[model samples]
Target: MIRNTRSGWGSISRWFHWILAAAIIGMIGFGWWVNHVPARPDRFFYRSIHADIGYLVLLLMVLRLVWRAANPTPALPADSARWTRVAAGISHAALYLITILVAVLGWAHSGAHAPDYSSFFGWFHVPQFTTPDREAARAYEDRHILFAYVLLALIAVHVIAAAWHHYIRRDRVASRMVASDAGTSR
Candidate 1:
């Protein structure tokens, strides 16, 4: 199905979910590597790539939010506990909010650095919202790192919850995202 039904996610939603999940996870690891690399000419190359990806992530996330708002989300299992449903809602919100915050923080950090690296793949210059200051850059970088860790923790919890639904509850909650919804009725 191209559009989601009450019973399960559609192809578009699943694609967005999986693609964002992979991109966000990969970005986290790549960002870590970029931070750890020694100062070298090629380090700027890696930083530029990371900045470009961060821009793309920010754009994709906005589109995903729009898509989500316009679409029908699959309902949770009827037997799910009230707390489980509440937790699911809160976690999903945090995921979206934190993802956006991290991207913005990275952008701000890049802009504030003495040697700005906020260009979009060298295609065009991204406007720096703040004056280039080493101290400000460091502060933004620190918050970026802290929130990134929070995002990572949230992802771990999300994965565990999905596993619990799939294994312990033996419900179709997890499969609703991974499997085709063609056979599912509204």
Candidate 2:
């Protein structure tokens, strides 16, 4: 279904969740790989791809936020514990906040470090908003790394919680956000 039911997520929501999850995870690995590459001409090409993907991620994040705001999420299972619901709410909020921050920091980091200009797939250019500064770039990069770790930890918790609900609680909490078999026909 296109709209969420009381028991599960809509297809749009499921697509957004999984797509963003994959993009973010891939960007994390790409970011690390680019940093480790030897100083070669091809490294710049890889960095350009990273920057393009970062911009795409930012766009997706914005779209996801709008989608989330416009749509209703499935309600927690009726039998869920109060603490479980509360934790879910907080963790979800944190995930949103951190995702936004990570994207912004990446953009800012690029602006702060770019020697000449930032290009998006060579079709367009993203202006560097901040003046290039070695120190500031270092600081932004450090925070980006730190928050990335935090995001990773939150993802682990999210996955574990979903597994707990699915396997231990035998509830729809996990499936609702997954493929959405109408919120859990199981």
Q: Summing lDDT over every window of 10 consecutive residues in candidate 2, give the lowest-scoring window.
A: 177-186
lDDT of 1 by residue, 34-141 (tens): 999989889988988988888888889999899889988888877779999999999999999999999999999988987888678768988878779999999999
What TM-score do all the candidates reach, one by one? 0.94, 0.92
lDDT of 2 by residue, 38-109 (tens): 899888788778878888888888888898888887888777789988999999999888978887787788
Candidates' C-alpha lDDT: 0.88, 0.82
Give the Å shift of residue 138 in candidate 2: 1.3
Top candidate by TM-score: 1
- For model 1, state the Cα shift of residue 17 in Å: 0.9
Inter-residue clash pairs, candidate 2: none
